[model samples]
Target: MPAAKSDSPGRVRRIARLIFRVCLFGGLAAIATLVVAVLVTMASLPSFADMMQKPNGQTVRVHASDGSLLLSLGPSYGDWLPYDRIPAEMRNAIVAVEDRRFYSHPGVDPIGVARMFYVAKRLHDEGRRLQGGSTITQQIARNIFLSSKYSYGRKIREAILALAMERKFSKAQILELYLNRVYFGGGAYGIDAASRKFFGHPGDKLNLAEAAIIAGLVKAPSHYSPSADAQAARDRASVVLDVMVDAGTLTPAQAKGVNLDSVTFAPEPKQNSVRYFTDWALSQLDTIVDEQAAPLDVWTTLDKRMQDAADASIRQNTPKDLQGALVSMENDGAVRAMVGGTDYVTSIYNRATQAQRQPGSAFKLFVYLSALEAGVKPGDPVVDEPITIDNWSPRNSSRRFLGPIDVRTAFAFSINTVAAKIGQQVGFDSVADMAHRFGITTQINTHPSMVLGTSDVRLIELTRAFAAISANGNAVTPYGILKVSTTDGTVIYQREAVQPRVLVAPFVAAEMTDLLQTAVNVGTARAAQIGRPVAGKTGTTSSNKDGWFLGFSSGLTTGVWMGRDDAKPIPGLQGGRNPAQAFSAFMRVALQTRPAEKFATDPTLPEWQLEPDDEAYFGNPDQGFGGDGAPAPEAQDEVTGEVPDVQPAPGDVPPPADTPAAPPRAETPAEPQLDQRWLDNVLRDQKRPPQSPPRGN
Candidate 1:
């Protein structure tokens, strides 16, 4: 029965022929349609010439604050360089590692693609991730234009786009764009940035070992970064070098010349000395000029060497608990150096210009200046005795009666009672006016306490104020930039000298200088003396909240302040200690090269007493003083630190017999014999009232 059912050979042959003919016709039609579809798609795309004509985005070069080149900051997209800049070894390494037959076909290599497909299939079978077979150009296309929304449709689109790109752009162009745009990790967007970020210089400057290491970084930047994994980076570099040798991109002899182990990297240079000054000048310029995009190159008066020395000095001298700021300028108002803080890294807030704090005894300079302007000689007998003005009976910082102290002693020791007396006599308004005229721009109260630095003042303002004394009493506005030049050497900005007279005659200025020198050599500011001729003043505010050391020499004038950011005091830390130490250390290094010169003093300058201003001593509005008529000490003649020879009875110095005695001890425990005038003004309001004795006693 099965033999009878068997089909004839002719029918089997006809069926087979029919099946073959139908399959062939269908395949031909499908092929024709696919070709037409591809042609239409190509026709719709931009012409090759038009695609090539697109402009790359702008490239902006970033420079250091001092105009030194740090890097070129290019846009994250679109910008590219020529492939000629790329090393041949790098190109070969990429081809050998990624697509072996990259140049053998058009944009999409069919055989390589097929081989990739087979590998991917194998990997999938083995439960592994799909390996890539993209040519460099194809990768560039995928990375630039396509989102990683994985799908068969996306893959087809990417292939078509890659083909379009290859047709439009040269291989060199495509490769350059790809290399520039590829992510190299560590926040580096391109090979150039990667070169800088990893090796601390430009890409073109790299050695062979560095080049190999960077070439290896393309595989997995973080994994091969020398900073992240030194051994891994070395291993990857070795492999990359081996690949170069195998591809014949590098000869064996040349490969031998390249030492992967010899590649060394340098630490990024920190240009901080000029940074603060540059920032200051920029800030000033921004405020002065309306246009921010003016592309200005400011020429500041910042002495780079001096600034570095000042910073170094502050670091060396300041205690762990202290932070310091220094500003120095010539009598002509050319700022030589400035230290904004001990570590600008720790706090960018500039203590020289940005911080506002009480001045303490340093404020007494204004009072004395005002007093001298008011025709009161330094020898004027302003009683040191505690006197009552309003309801306040102010005493010295020691809270005891000091007998027969002079004005010079009051200022040298920073006697609070005498400083108040002088401020009252000269009129607090006059002191405030002097402070303002001397370039102190902060708001100040016209109270007796203001004479003691109760008002807030920034270090810059005080620096300028002190500069007046340095300039023979001519107030000088501290300026930084001398001129700003464009890249092409066009002068875009220039600084102008503005000098305003704020004090009396140059004789008075000379007299003040002598007294200040005495202050340093034999008084409260003795700690500020250097081996060379130097002058400065030490000021400690109430509760040790703010420690101030302001001084100036011929070479540099710097002021340091030490305290907590908030008004709280650090334990066992004072301006005289840490701030003074920093100033001394900094000045020592700064003035090393400069010839030592004595401070200018005139013998023609009239001699003045160092007596405390009796009215100032008794008349502080913050503390009401009753006219109890305490016995006051007479103003003593100016003397060095040595004890006076003609010492009268302590009770009968010079003031009225009924005048009260001034404090016998110094305000600060560290200096028991110094005066305490300016400090009393700061603490008068905060000072505790005299305690009443027990009734039983």
Candidate 2:
């Protein structure tokens, strides 16, 4: 029995020694594997300089013409602040709230990591998110060299990189790098940028309360942003102050005395309409300048007051269910104000620049301009009788044809038949060319109905065409970017002041302006007259699906469009009613400070005297086409799916007498008489009877 007991003790000791040897080898293997992993990760990293560079490329800061900040595009990084430049309060607050043992730890805090895992496991048991355990130096390592991917391998690499950073950089250097690289809410990337964005100053000027508020954002930037919710930010700041007190950086009394209420935030703009302009301006940057690695300051032509005025006009005039867009530019094509929709936040679609809706009768400007360019005199007689071409007949909005009216009267009343006749005479291709020459970039359909604006057009381009007329025949290319420079004002791109291309002869433009003036003064666009010499055109599509008004006064040309996004009709909607009133309202405020200017009149062209027959046919200007003192409705152009209600003609009305006498004005020269026989022959051809359909077999 004694011999068996001794053998058992010896066997137990052998088993203990064998287990110890196995554990020792396993520990050694683990150490060797860790060393290999560290080496491989180190070799894969880029150089430190490359690592410290901003991850997202360059930022672009757009400014208005008056030097006011419109908005920042991309991540905005301010000038880097040295350790001395960073306020003590900001540094202490950041260290206290983010990592209390930052100064004492060797890059990675073991205690912090252990506490994080414990808390994370407890939170996981309760069905919550896992908590982060990133020290200040570890955070710097992850931000610079790695991404926020969760894995033990990533954590190990982060710790190793943090150790390497600590070995290379001083404590102050590490803190400075952290302060300069951290992201704050509102697109600010650094302490100085956050300070300037939130408090309108630099980081060196931050007080205790401001520092606490900014530091609190390091946890959840969007949630604790002061601009987003001031009270929540203040409460977060209080928590940061409490942490500072616990860390012994500030006394309890000192923390209590820091008045977060006294921290005043920078005032935000009242209107977000400017974002639409900024978005458009940003799109042009790549085309203007080469790909830039450094930040750019883009100065645009947006006028804040004019934008506000436009927003107010649209909100007040546009109906609740419908949407409206407006674009205004100088005679030289510097876009001043643009409102894409009623609210930019809900819809980012820039209707003024993006949407291509039918311009309706407002497009007649191009048709008439084409006619004038073809040597058709405004005073020449044209028949407004019913006409059909290619089995398609167009009717006037009034449904009553004024027989043998002068070209000016027909255009002023938006006579669809006369416009179609003029379009055919001038050639639809010629009208399309005229629109293109005036800056329309969209494709134009050349169907017979296209003369009445069947082809869809953008509001911005349409406004630019009118601006060309307002600028005395000079072609305008709409531009918003005035200059693009570096942060230190190094000029990268500046729009060179060049004389505009002359698209039309001054006399032709003058003639067109005369027709437009008649449109606003005595025709369908009478609602757009702002007690000044305003010239504009009104257009309404079939069933009132789209309403539009394009006008110009002083040195500005503005266009307004109102419609449903789905192209559905609005009840009782007409271009002359709402769109014209909106234009007038906006222009009144836009041109309030500027002097009223008269449209250029061609003295060479003679004014036609009213004949007795013509006078009876054309009623009072204010009473409109009905001659009952009721305002004329907008001209509705025919489109697909719309059928014209053609009423039976009363009888064939005879042509008016040829060659009316010319009235004399003090400023006008002696007028040359037009060839009446040529004019009559042209009118007769336009008034030809329609061909009858062949009998069915």
Candidate 3:
């Protein structure tokens, strides 16, 4: 027994020695691995000078024609402020919230690290994850040199880089770099940009409360942005103030007197509608300039005054449940004002440029333009009786038609039967071709009812078509960007000043203008007249699903559209009732500073006169038409039909190689001759005023 006990003691001694050697070797291997990781991280580090000098990323700042800032496209930055220029309160607040021992610690704070470890152990035991414990310098290292991905190796690298940075730069220089590089939310980088974005002032002017608010944002930007939630931001600022008191940067009494309630943020823009314009302009940037790494300044053709006017008109005129869009442009297609919807915040879908809705009678401009181009005169007589083609019957809005009326009178009244008859007289293909020639890019379904504007179209494209008419038959391409340049005034792209392509003959445009003028003066669009030589057409789709007014005056063309997004009918809605009035209201303000100009008049053509019955229905030439009567409604504009194949079948389409072809059928006229009595009445009506004609409802 004594010998066994002696052996047991020796075995215990050997086991202890083995454990000690194994632990020592393991510790050395771990140390060696850590050292190698540090060395690798150092070698891969980005140049310190380059990191400090470079911006976060390329930004595109959009501005209005008058040089007012509209919005920024990418990461927004301001000029870097030096240490001396930064407010003392801002520096103090940042230090108190981010790192109390910012001045005393070498970049890796020992106390903070120990606390972080203890917290991490506790969290692990409770089934939670560890939170970050980076000091100001460590944050600078991570932001400038390393990715935000967290791992043991990343932390070791962060510490090593921070320590190196502290050794190279002074405390003031390090702080200045951190302030200028950190993201401050709201797409703003750096204190200067954040200050201007939230408070509308520079960083040098930050008060204690404002400084605290800005300082509190480093931890959670979107959650506590003042622009997002003022009360939450103020509560966070109060926490920052408390930290400042604890850090001895401010006395308790001084902190107590600071009123977060008195802190007022800058007013947000009246509406986010400008974002729609900016989004459109940004899309064209790639086509205009080559892909660039530096920031750019895009000067656009937005007129703030006209944009505000259009917004107000839509807001005040449109019903609450319905939506409205307005687009205004110069005669050359430079878009000056555009409101995509009633509120862009609720819906970013730009109705003015994106949504395609049927433009009712307003589309008749193309049909009439085609007829005039085919040698149909404005004073020519047309029958407005009920008609049917391909089992499809179309009637006038009034349900009763003026049997025999001149082309100008029928157009002014927006008579549906007359437009359809004209479409047949001039082939429907010609009408669709006319629309394309005038700048409408949407597909046109050319049915008999197409003359009444059945196919869908975007509001902006329709406005561009009208701009062509206003430009005296010249084609217009809608554009917003005027010039693009660098921040230092180096021009990257300037719009080339080229002559516009001619799309229509001047004589045809003149006759179309005459028809449009008659519509505004004594027909469906009477509400759109602005006490000047203005011309426009009113459009109302079936069940009042869509209403439109496309008009021009004072060298500007504006198109207004009102409808429900779901294509549901709005009770009692008509093109002349709300759409025309909105157009007039917007144009009145848009042209307040400009003089009214007259459309080109054809001196050789005979004077346009209304039929005897039409003169009585209009009541007075000075008061215009539809005084107390309801504005004309549109007939059912569309009907479902199978589209015929324009091309023949591929198989068995041609005769056999040896077969003889059949003879062609006898020719038939595409249109019947107009009644001579109607033409005789039209010529006689222009010579004298009517004596007594029946009044119309």
- The local lDDT score (0 to 100) that residue 318 gets in candidate 3 is 77
Off by over 4 Å in 2: 1-61, 68-104, 109-134, 141-161, 168-180, 190-271, 291-293, 592-595, 602-697
Instruction: Give the winner by lDDT.
Output: 3
Prediction-by-prediction clash tally: 37, 0, 0
lDDT of each prediction vs. the true structure?
A: 0.61, 0.77, 0.78
What TM-score does structure 3 among the candidates reach? 0.75
Clashing pairs in 2: none
Which numbered prediction scores highest in TM-score against the true structure? 3
Candidate 3: C-alpha RMSD after superposition? 13.6
* Error at 298, model 2, angstroms: 2.5
What local lDDT score does residue 684 receive in model 3, on the 0 to 100 scale? 70
RMSD of each: 14.8, 10.9, 13.6
Q: Tens digit of lDDT per residue, candidate 3, span 166-191?
A: 76677898899899889888888889
Name the TM-score of candidate 2: 0.69
